[model samples]
Target: MVLFVVAKEETLQKPMYLLLCILAVTEIGGTTCIMPKALCIFWFGFKGITVDGCLTQMFFLYLFAVTHSAVLVIMAFDRYVAICDPLRYTTILSNARIAKLGLVGLIQAVLLILPLSLLLRKLPLCANPVILHTYCEHIAVVKISLGDTRVNRMYGLVITVVNIGLHLTLIGLSYGLIIRAVLRISSKKAHQKALNTCTAHICVMLMSYTPFLFTALTQRFGQDNAAHVHILLANLHLLVPPMLNPIIYGIKTKELREKTAKDKDKGSNDKAELLSHTYSDPAGA
Candidate 1:
């Protein structure tokens, strides 16, 4: 969070700071949205998962899931702007415009997730009372449904393909354009820097999103080990990005070093003033 705030300060001239704030908020929302459901899942077994409790968890979890995906999509767009449209990047992604788009994304995510919440609520929990994964994932919760789940399953599959697969494709396409644009630059230093920036974004995105598709795909075909792998991946999906994003972003941008230097200078001056005041006091002398 501090890194984000510092980035906001360093990139004050660009619209990148605003994007950073949006990404920071989405990350917080995405990672915490499932906490209530996860607490209940761990505290009481699936049998204890009441109808209302399950629905409530499902709602927020779904909201965060969609929001998380949308934030990632927005990040890709940010990259596109930085790489392909550098000339008008500030004007194109003005603070007001970025905020409006973010608001739209948040609303769309809520609208998308709400219907899933309602759909899942209508289904009855069957006699079998085990959720295979550590968290309250939609598939894990639905696997034990007494009523027909074909509709839910189909919808889930469609969403996964669209949200994960399609989004990834678009990100790839954006990078392709970015790469092409960078190559057109004759300056070797400039080209390498551009590539480096895109590389960091790609690495972070792969780490964040690949395990998700793996877990989702494995759940359909794999056996006992699949559940454990999915759980591990889910935890990784939660843990790794938040841990790495700031570091990767800081290094990629080169702004953290500048901010750190400024902070250290400020601290030294503050310390010098304190020492001067201490010695000036009669009691101290």
Candidate 2:
């Protein structure tokens, strides 16, 4: 649906839609990195993965996760500009600027996760090779390492603080400004409309981050929970946002809904034309 919007809708060629497209693609990438292996484990009983393969999966899992979070931060900024400074939004968040922001997010996610792979490569696995979860995760893999993981832990902390902490703070601050701006508007209808515009994004943010926050907190502090519970929340955090983001946006955002409807009508007309051409007589009967 997002791809369709990008391809067909000329009006949606703005930065907001471009960011949404990137986010949709990123979400797909993130979930694909883990879900296939998870399904194989469930259906085919193919649970074992090579160490190098595990590391690769871990890299992509964190890469996409970090990228998605960064994208959300960008989105928060986008919303802030759109709502708080509507007149300057076009000039501020031009296509080139949006592209740069997207590139930065991609690079940041890659650079942050790159060190994890390098650190994992250095660690000697002396514990049981079996990974309890459905897919490879950095902390899970690090826990089984025999060598000193102080540096790995420290780097992990830094990564979490930078990626999650910084992004969340920025998002919160963006929303804070957005709220302040919204309140300044004297028209209640405009205020409501502006808030409505942000609803899908807020939902997507909550869906994407809340479960991950829970899982991370549990992993760091709540050790008494069952392994299955941890795995379940992890899977939810990785999978649910991707699955729900489009749905939430489609339902909540008027433009997306209208575009989808237009696409459907266009598809139907194209199908009808194809049928007419297929059944029409060669002799112009």
Candidate 3:
């Protein structure tokens, strides 16, 4: 639905919409990486996955996750430009530039996560082959490995800290500036309007990161935590954002709502016209 709307609607050809389209694709890709296998395990009792296959799945899962985070950072920048610098927003975030940003996000994720898979390949798994979680996760895979995982752990920590920290920092900075700019407006209506534009993105960003943060922290620090809780949070971290993003944005964004309403009205009119024509020609038939 998001792809169709963004592609067909000329009014949605701006950088904000382009970013949204990219985000939609990222969400779909991220969920696709894990959901099918998860459903297979749940419904068909097919839980066994080979080491190489698990690694592959983990790679794509983290790749999509990292890319999603990077995309959120880009979105923060988008909102920042839209709110803090309205006149120069177009100049700074042109279509080509937005496309480039999307590409960069994907590329960065691949580069950062590719090494983890390579490291996984080196680890010798002597423990039970069964993964506790629904899908293959990097930490879970590494934890089960018997080989020296010092390098993998160090690298994983670095990547997590750097990737998540950088994204959060940039988003925070962008929102800080946006808030400052928004507060400068004397009119309460203008202030509300400007903040309203950012509200959806803010919700999305929080939704995207909060679950993962809790899960990661708990996995690392909480020694007495339940396995089911960890698994649940991990799955939710992957599934919730993709499923809810379109609905949230559609409800929060006026343009999307208007477009949806227009499409519905057009369909109704077409159906009515077809019914009228059919009735009118009944005698001829």
Candidate 4:
């Protein structure tokens, strides 16, 4: 909400602000669309899939999947700018540049997940169709398909490799640079602050990525109530980070706190201006 308002005005020139907005929007989509669909499928079961509904759910799942993955990539880049190129960080991660990266991420996500629909669409639903967890996840949904899921399995393998491999590569690179930067900082305070920032990001990444990887591996290896564990972890992966991000940033970063204060000031000023303008005519005279 604050990001939306900050982005609306011209004064907020911070690159990180735009990054925050991108993160917020992406997480909102993940939480609202992906989480709910997964939970609904797990809890209530699918409501008689029409040919259209299946396709629609699949599309939304695709959208959520891509956006979530892309957002992680975007964040890795953001960290890179902040740590690796602090001097040119503003120019490197300008609003336009961030917007472009975000678009590319979104596009990449969409393209990557498009195959899932094609691969899994025609496969027959299983007999004992109970999603172990609270969501209709890509893998869980696919697990029960009676048809030859070799193609689906292959595509899933590709997605797992690409998504995990790419995002982890970028994140690893960013943190490598970040660690160097932190080490170079003479001030203990500065080093601690840098470590603290990345700590939240690292925690989020662990929570988000670990379950997906575990689930994928377990499925391939003939796992058990691991599905139930995977489902619980999956929900936590989606829910915990998003809920934590704003709170952590708000509490830890002085810049964000100041910006929030300034935003409040700006709001008060705007309300004052409106009141003055409204009564500034003959009534005031």
lDDT of each residue in 1-285, candidate 1, tens digit only: 444445546455455656555666666666676655566666874335666766676677667666666667777788888889888877887878877877877797777677776787888876667777656678887887889999888888887777777677877888788888888999999988878766666776777777677767777667566467777777677767766776676676666556756677877999999999999998987
Lowest-scoring 10 consecutive residues by lDDT in candidate 2?
276-285
Give each model's clash number: 0, 0, 0, 5
On lDDT, who's better, 1 or 2? 2
Model-by-model lDDT, in order? 0.72, 0.88, 0.88, 0.71
Candidate 1: give its CA RMSD in angstroms. 3.4
Query: Candidate 2, residue 196: CA error in Å?
Result: 1.4
Candidate 4 lDDT by residue in tens digits, 99-159? 7887888888778877787777788876656544455567777776789888887887898
Model 3 lDDT at residue 54: 91
Candidate 4 to truth, TM: 0.77
Q: Decide which is better by TM-score, 1 or 4.
A: 1
Q: How do the residues 162-223 of candidate 3 rate in per-residue lDDT, one tens digit apiece?
A: 99999999999998999999889999999999999988998888788888888888877776
Candidate 3 Cα misplacement greater than 4 A, ranges = 283-285
Q: lDDT tens digits, residues 160-277, model 2?
A: 8778989999999999999999989999999999998889899999998888888888876778989888888888888877888999888997787898998899899999998788
Worst 10 residues of 3 by lDDT: 123-132
